[model samples]
Target: MAPQKAAQEFVGHKLLDREGNNVGRIEQIYFDDRTDKPTWVSVQTGMLGRRHSLVPLQGARVNEGDLMVPFDKERIKDAPDLDVDRHLSVEEENRLYRHYGVQVPGPRRGMQDQGDAQGRHAAGAAEETGMAGRATGEHGTDTRAANARAMNAEAADARTAEADTRSGRGRADAMADEDITMVRSEEQAHVGVESRESGRAHVRKSVDTEHFEQDVPVSHEEIHVERVPLTDEDRATAGNAQIGEEDEEIILHAERAVVAKETKPVEKVRISKEKVTDVQHVEGELRKEHVEVDREADHLTEDDYRGRRRPPAG
Candidate 1:
């Protein structure tokens, strides 16, 4: 594409070096005073894009939505620092042209044309004044006076034109300087949770001894004796029986309470953990930047100062 088109489209786009390394973003483009074509571009570089550097657009190209210049990233960044607040002087432009190895633009066409017109007009006026002086008697004095006035008039007109040019250039420079931006920032609270050992829990077992009592029914054997008078049948039987000493014995069985010990698991015991979610209120003091308009005109309202309403009162 043409250099003028490229320059127009390069603003706010990413700028890359020949090696495809990103130098910065293109902030503004400058035109040559003679040809009025794109000559230089200001790139926002350094940390957070706080610094701006001027790079030549002589061999620059637009590639994939990026402005690619035929220079190294370091070279572009280290170029000579010049104020971007005013039109570049001839010496400054020459220095930059040398640094970037680009040819300087030729003399301005408008200036050349203006000079030619002024010369023609002066010649015609001088001729007319000479003719008028000769037609009369005072040729020398009248010619000298007419020439002096003509010179003074031309000088005044040149000064006026120069002042107007400077004024217009100053306005353009002010517009370019506005490209510098102010970033208002603020602090934010990033909340999150992490696992940490707040405390611990333990389960243990211990034994305790205690006395117990209960009632049980039991029985034992008892001995009893009885005596009676003998009859006739007993006397008859006694004739055949021999009287001799006799012995009797008996055995008894009874139940008694017995105590024994045994071990068995009656309940389950263990240690475990579970997550319990809860909402907690966190407090912090955050800092932020606030922008306010401080103008010299005390009569200007907020709307007027912001240019949203009428012009400033003063």
Candidate 2:
């Protein structure tokens, strides 16, 4: 793995964990005061980028266009809430340290080493006093006194060191216990509609009769047998003609009105809905305190005595 670039180049870069999970984008970068190196980053998260989170930049480096961190997405997002618009306060820094369980480098670390050396010297001096005090009783008394003095000094230093640690921890706890009261009030509106009969509609259907006409073709036949032809030629051909039996045949066809029924669709009916908007006046009452001032009470005393200010009547 290569070392990451500076914050300027790391800006606008996405942050991902070792498992390639997206944490957020680097919205800001904060540099440590002593080292002057970027150690914290503000990430823009949540929907619409409305939420911003602070995350440690330890083990984070720019890989290509993204910044990779060795922390989880949720851990970074749930870090201590501190605004990065200005320098980080001591209380806020301590809070972040406590959240990560990282020990703060004490300014008096060398003092602890000095205290250890002093304790060792005191122990060696007491050992020498014990070895020497085994001789003359009077000298033993003085050496024993010196031994007790060194032992007391070592105990006092130990107590001082312990008190300092407790006091530092107490201050952090006090800051964490600072109380904040937030009062929020809001009004909600309710919109409702009920089903009611607005109006009525009626549909009536009727049938009216009218005259209709049509033409139909009919067929008939007229038959005539000629007797005059026989009468005129009967006298002239009576001598040369002898009549025998004759036969005649006819074929007739007649047409009447043909009637058949047929069905067809003309009109249909149904119910439909349409959306409409309307404004209605709403009425309600609210409770509020109204103050009344009287000029006659201008001379009223501002304070009242707590003990025996007035006697209650029976």
Candidate 3:
């Protein structure tokens, strides 16, 4: 593994093959979730229009200009795909290591000592160490040691907080500000009618009522119907017993003959309206604080009678 540098720095760096030929660029970087360290550098290498292959970063050399690896462009491009879900199984890791002649580092191997981790607390410890030495013991050496330990603990806390902020765990509190709303409306209709009659007075009464309500959409149509009536000659023949050539009769009622019919409007349909609205908001606040944990730090002062003070009551 390379030194801990920002992942963005190596995003577009060039990768070289063992035969001194130019490969492709670094398409992506893969990190080990358990240790929060980059474990693989997925280099894309191939010809102009062909499928690129992902080469692992294990045992790859970091030259001054670019990353150097034992396998050339062709071999790297032809390497079997790396399924991140099954990222280089133990056996596969070993086989690739042997094939490329690279040594894979052991797991994270955290800091060997708490004292060493003190360097990580730079931001937080700076706040408390400046307090008055009156809280310390008469012995300067003891006071200095306690101060140093307090600083280290503060620094560790700061580092942990920084990690949480970067990993998106610290934004949980801010997510509570989001708001939601719902609106609904409905309508109903009803009708009632009553009637009464009296037999002795010979009186009668009637009641009528009509009610309608709809939440449906409107539709329209056209309707037409054919109408016909008896002709003048037919009506006159029906009224008279005999008919003469000179006889003339006239029909008072108007009549129509059957012909093509075109319908314009056939039925009535209901119509309704509805309105909906949605509001979105990005709500949240992000905050972080450093909490110090001093494992080996204390203050001591002399009393008027006993040369040393006792511990504070819980």
Each candidate: what lDDT? 0.79, 0.70, 0.59
Off by more than 4 A, model 1: 1-6, 108-314
Error of 3 at 162 (Å): 47
Q: Output the lDDT of residue 196, model 2.
A: 65
- Those runs of model 3 whose alpha carbons end farther than 4 Å from true positions after fitting are 1-4, 58-65, 84-92, 107-314
lDDT of 1 by residue, 1-314 (tens): 34677567878889999999989888888887666678888998665665678888878887898889998998777676678768877777778778877786665455678899999988987886666666455654566666666776797799899999999999999988866568898766556655669997777778899999988887777665678888999988888787799997787667788778999879986667888999988897978899876757478678776786556688
Residue lDDT tens for model 3, 206-241: 767667554644444435458889899878888855
TM-scores for the candidates: 0.36, 0.35, 0.28
- Model 2 earns a TM-score of 0.35
Q: Model 1 lDDT vs. the true structure?
A: 0.79
lDDT value, candidate 2, whole model: 0.70
User: After superposing candidate 2, which stretches have Cα over 4 Å from the reference?
Assistant: 1-5, 101-314
Candidate achieving the largest lDDT: 1
Candidate 3 similarity to native, TM-score? 0.28
Flag clash pairs in model 2.
none
TM-score winner among the candidates? Answer: 1
lDDT of 2 by residue, 1-314 (tens): 22235475777878897677887777877876655667677888655565677776667766667988777777666575567688786677668767755565453334667998999988986786665566336664666666666776797799899999999999999899877555554433344555669987677778887777889786766676676445666677677655799787787656678867686888887767786888888776534445554556444454554334677879
Clashes of each: 0, 0, 8
